[model samples]
Target: MNTNLSNDNEFENDAESRIETEVSSEVESTPEESGAEENLIEENISTSETAVSPTSAEITTPIEDNEAAGEVKEVKTASAATSNNQGMSAMAKGLAVIAVILAIGAGLVFWKMKVGTHGESLNRVTAEDMQIILKDANPMQLKALAESPEQKKKISENIAQLLAVASQARKDGLADEPIVKQELENIRAVVTASIYDQEINKDKGPMPQFGYISEDQVKEFWNDTSHEAEFQKFIDSKLTLARESGKFPKDKELTEEELKQAKDDFAKIMIYAEEAKEKGRDLGEDFNREVELQVKLQQAQFLAGRYAQKVLADKVKVTDEDVAKYIAEHPEYDTKEKKAKAEQILSRAKAGEDFAKLANEFSQDPGNKSPSGELQGGIYKDVPKGQMMPAFEQAALALESGQIADNLVETPYGYHIIKLEKKGEGKDANGQPTQTYDVRHILITTTVKDPTNPMGREIPVTESVKAKLAEEKQKQVLDEIVANNPVEVAEDFTVPQPSQEDLQQMQQQMQQQMPSRMQPPPAGDIEPPNSQEPKKPQPRQ
Candidate 1:
């Protein structure tokens, strides 16, 4: 019986030892054996976000299973709360930034509406005030004009009238006209564009005194298809303004090649303007001022022109009878008497008369005289074809040596009694033979001087003269309007005159720049870098 009890105890001890060994093996398994099981546990934990807690059945160690599971859950909850707080903080920062931007915008609007009143008032347009509107206006030019009190007053009066007319036009709803609106827009765009180009090139070393657009930029702009519509609008506006000024033919149209050349010539200005807008360069102070000046100038001019055409046409119309009356008052403007005088001289020259004697006695052409204003026998040496007027050049070219033109040749300046002294040939700078002629002629002066000029000296009757004549009548009308409106010029807003030393320095600088100005510009296949072809329209006076 004792031996049987011993056998049973040994068997119990062996089974208990084997169970202990199996549990140890499961808990401390090799990485290679548990790799697949680890992957499944990781995926389950990520998807379900289930906190891993050891079940009572799995926990064989001395540690308390429920307490350990509770600790793990608390750690995860704290970490998640930290992440949520961070997200909320970031969202709050974004909202705060947006609110600040809105506040800044509101402040700007408020300042422009309230505080900007004095700056923009037209009732008192001062030189300092004009500086805001005409920022790019040459300081030297203003100083020069201000040197004369008369000039300063004239400027003030002109500006006042312009503002008054523009104001009236707005009230009349003329600003709403599509054509007028487009013209104002064109002026603003062009002036802004010009300012932008100048600013960018301000640091590029010495430039032309008047400034010039770059050729490479112009070429690039011509090829660009973008902004084509804007280009067309500008061209149209320029033409319309020109036509309104009565400076160009009513039926004028740009030729195909001319249009392309125009594009290249004006490309830098228009394209840079577009770029300035896109790049927000238009917000610059200089650009803004020039734009405002040009826009206001164009608007005023447009309104004034329309008013002159519609309202003052009959009141200011110069009749043939008026011209005759003017000629009677100023005998020097009598072209009919001058033409007869030219015919008489031409007959004598053709009637075996000594041409030089006739030219000395009868020629009134200032160019036909010496620097001392003495008649130089009206002899032009080696005259080129294009140097003379069409009728004068034609008559001279048709004549043989020592032969006089059969009839008096008429031109804007006067009637010419041309005597061909000799035909000649000359070599140009390129060493190419060029046709030239030497001629003796008596000129009968027919051009009328500006009635307003006290000197009444013989001067070219340019567009400026015509404008002055027109302005005389317009001024009468504007004076009445201004009397009613009553604008004021600021007393303290004075322009400083340069000292004599300053003037000398300016003259010396101009002299120094003469050589560079005379030098031929860099060559370009598209357009001359400085070409102002398809000439920009002049603003109305």
Candidate 2:
């Protein structure tokens, strides 16, 4: 019983020991497990820290039920960034479009303004404005006005003023004055007559076959006539006057000195004459033909003048008052005393008397001879102021009314003693006339030398060589004329005898003057069928 009891106690103690050992083992296992858990917790904390360091700590936290909200926030941020970028791009594009549109619009506006403004300014100008602009404008200014829009406005304003003045003058009835009417008529007549003469000359074909007036005929007439002798007589009388006036050399009795001077003068005259002849000769057949045409023209002019006088006689009316008015206006016209008397004076002056003394002695002027020198008469009413050379006009103007000027009035023609028998009112304070002379002069001119040919080719005869040859030829022509001279009685000269061909031409011309209906067709041509009752034969000459 005691052993059994002791074994139970040992078993109890072993069991307690085993339980304790097991508990200890369990505690150790718990420690190991706890250690393992600590290690794991430490590792997890380190990993979490590392992750938090690399990423956000908030990301490591578990998202709540508001994860969708976070996602929405993120989405909103992305959207905002995208919208901002898109907005910038859209703004950039909008600005570019606006800039292009504004630029194009500005260009269009500028172009329209420029075109419209220039067009309006141009339309405002008138023809008269244009004329004035053209008239007074300098070339550079005109170019600017033409090209630049700004300048054209100023040019148009200047021209309007001139037209106004011209219009006023016409409205004053100045255009209908008798003098104005006469002047207009004269201008019209001149223009019309020129046209008529041109037409008539055109109608007349080139001159007849004789190469202008038969040179043979001209030479014959010149030689047969006593005109040259008469002309020489007149020249001798002029020379005598010159001698008496002491214009010639003083050794009057044909002394050796006088003879020598005379010979020298004659030689000079002969030289001039020879030169004139040469010039006339060098004017070839064309010139001769022109001369014939001139003769015909002169004849035509005379006939036309007569016809014009008859046709226009009613238009020209003269009154005594008109004549008096004319004389009053033209003081140089014949004075009452001059018209009343025909007394002439020839003062006997000493040979070689001073020109002033001669003038004083012979002057018929009513004014004192102290300031007056040479005096004469026969000045026409239509004499011009400066037409007489400066010297003559100065002398004439210097004298008082009816006063003779000092010294002989030398001119291209000869010396003259100016007489102031009449006093007249002058247009100016100085006795100058207001009227401008419109005189028509017909010049019968002779040149000493022939002009150089247009082609620069040498003439058949040089100027120096022509004179002698021309004189010889003229003499030969004269001789031929004398041989062939023919005389016509007054009856025979009454009418010109036309040649057969000329008569035929005249008949044709008369026929042409008739209506076209009067003309007959050519003999070879057949008449149109049923055109006329009978075919007419060609008209006989």
Candidate 3:
């Protein structure tokens, strides 16, 4: 029964089952329950997308606020239980795995592919040419612009803002302004250098599950010429399997002709490879490195994920007692800053004010507000540790239902004031830590230094001040564009703001359908793999 995959698949589905059983909707929930968990994905990755900016007509017209926030994810039930159970011996499973491996002997045939060289070269740019680049360019260049992890989160938004700035320049007839001209030119340079430039990066960077390779990997590998044959082999294998598998549930089996055509489309990229070098606009070599890498990265990521699953997933151990013992031993987990913040929040809660009212009025967390601008009504239920920031999870585990934190909890996202609504191992059967929490919180984000120009040049501003100024100016420009072209959002594009509970449920469901992802350790704290220090425990994937 494909025993090699049995443990891997089950380890993947555990979270799915738990969230499936207990995720109640926060369609009526509180932001305090956000617990810094909302920022988890944001803390690690930036995706690359090739956005076709709004046409001039789209620019002048009232832009659609197509961002929607009403999604409710449906869950996937695990297939019927397999013969293998928790009691199976390690040796028995190993032997079964070996048997399966031997039965599926490999025959990898690599064929050399000739790359195509047919696209227009992006050598020189005129004013009009620059304008097109600005309008059509996406946030790919934003990757280089991100110097810090926090800045990376803002890159996409900044790209949108930059696009707005460019559009306003056109409307104001300031094409020749040095600032306008330079910004557009810089954007063009960034765009022309990118490999595959068409997808919008909404998946928070990597394909979840595999956690191995990503679009960024595609870019890095694109410049290397050695992977061409290897990549083609990968494509042939995947397409061959797809052709045989009949493409899953809907079963739109690939026709013979369709398979041939698909193969041809892939072949053309290789045949046309040299064309990329023609334009010589400094976009670099003519190899279809991006295409080749894209093909390879998917498989590479999956392989890595598989290896980790086989070797590491079983090492994770979580139980109610384990969590309680964890809390008892990790006193240093709390910082002086966090302790003070928790004390202040506790004082406010003890002053006899309604807790929910305080969460609505004073909490700055986005989770507090729903898609419809209504405050999410109740407590967040059955939040697994995997769904929460590690610090938040630790702090929550230290409390029980109706129990409030005596000290503050800090995570990369912010300070959290937690009140555990419910706590038990059985709350979520699918989560890594096994236990879950029904919790509420008040989030206090660290403040950024404000822009202050003390004296003129004699008493200069700090680098922080300079950065803040740039931010303020950028915002002013975006505000102008919004004023000129008010947003008229598409109904489908409205961003859904599910409650913390709903978010956890949906995330659990989504992860089940995806390749188990590897979320990087939060910024700065991530150590190199060879470090002698203990490794941070990752959320079981």
Candidate 4:
């Protein structure tokens, strides 16, 4: 039996050895399968080693794998949540900024449109103010305002009335009329032009070089001129009656001082009168014929003055009784006549004797020579009341007829050596007596040179120089303005042109309004309207 058991054991050992050999051969033949099997074995080994227990090992392997997978999924979800939150926050901020900008922009646009649309309604004006504003407006601007037919009709009706009222206002001394003001300006321009010519032109008179000239030349010129001689003769004739009546000194050659005064007075009158004449002539030329109208206007003025004088003539008569009555009424005009009388030492004055010395040497009055020499004239006539200084009037009043003032009288004009002549009376329009007197005058004068034309030659400026300078300056200013400013013109533009359709319509309308013959023929027709017939369209070739 022992022998039989030994044999069975040997057979089992042999079977186990054969099984091992078979497994080794299979691994060598299939390498990929071997590697996969080995990896599975390693995982199983690791799982087994980390297992808390045999059952735990089996459960933890799959549980741990599932936990790792769940953790990765949770991380991805958190990251996505954070990214979405950040995107939403940025969107909210963007929306807020857009809202604020839109609000401001909308408000500005609304305000601008409101102001622009209501500009005229916010500022109202009245009729008087409108008239004043429109008076000086250009024709185009006025036409724009009165665009409608009704407004234009109202303007036309009021314009004539307004002009008439404006004229009346001017006559009453108001100076607001544009037309009147323009006329006055034109007159002034003419006067200025005349003055320029007189000053610059050498042929008009004795051209002044510098300072003043004495009256000797003036007297000589006057005596040589026939017109002036005639005027002098007329003046002398008027004065002859006064001399014969012992009312004035005898006729004699005027002294150098007297001649000088007369020349100065004449020069002033001539200058002003010539200026007036020139201005009048300019106006006349712009209106009626030049010289004739100006002369007629002067004659009209003279006639008007004569008429006024005649109307007031009865009021200005004088008589001896009236003079006596005046003297009785005013004690100042009546005083004891001075017995002192002496010849004037005029020769001594001209012979280099001091004026004061000669005045004192002539011993006609008790007054000092200083005051006497300073006095300008011996008598005053045709002077308004209260014109003389109080002291001067008092001194003069104290003197009697034919009596000189004891002391020279100082007045605003100058110093005066007064002699009380005969007192007289005049009558007004009512024939009531008034104070009057006949007086005569002697004058001396001096002349002064014009500085603008020292050489007394005319300086002529040509039109070319004025035009060139004006054009250059204008171009310079225009270039500067254009350089500093930028302007844009619209892309699509065209000069206005009449359309063929418009011309045809206009012609048709004209034909409809007129008889066939009265209507205008075709544009190029040279034949008379009565001789022409309407041409028919020719057939196309």
List the global CA lDDT of all models: 0.44, 0.26, 0.31, 0.27
**TM-scores of all candidate predictions against the true structure:** 0.42, 0.16, 0.28, 0.16
lDDT for 393 in candidate 1 is 70
In model 3, the worst 10-residue window by lDDT is 107-116
Compared to the true structure, candidate 4 yields what TM-score?
0.16
Model 2 residue runs over 4 Å out of place are 1-384, 387-391, 421-503, 506-541
Residue 140 of model 4 has an lDDT of 27
- lDDT, candidate 1, at 21: 29
Please provide, for model 2 over 445-535, each residue's C-alpha lDDT reduced to its tens digit, 9 standing for 90 to 100: 1111223223221111112122222223323432332234321111111111234554454455546657774667665424333221112
Better TM-score candidate (1, 2)? 1
Top candidate by lDDT: 1
lDDT tens readout by residue for model 1, 348-413? 887888888887887765555444556667776765444455566778899899888888876545
Q: Candidate 4 lDDT, tens digit per residue, 1-541? A: 0000001001011111221222222233232222211111112111111211100011111100111111121111111111221222221221211111111111111000000010001012234323422332222223344444453343332222222222222333333333223322322222232233333343544343211324564455466566365334323432342232222345444455544443443433334334545665554433212222222221222121122122211222222344456546655432222111211233333344444444334433211212224432222343222223345445545656655444443221122344455445555335566553322111111111112224321111111122223234323433332244322212221212334543454455546656875766676313332211111111112
Error of 1 at 374 (Å): 11
Question: Could you give candidate 3's per-residue lDDT for residues 87-150 as a string of tens digits?
Answer: 0111112121111111111000000010001121122223332222222111222222222444
Please report, as a residue range, the 10-residue window in candidate 1 with the lowest summed lDDT. Answer: 1-10
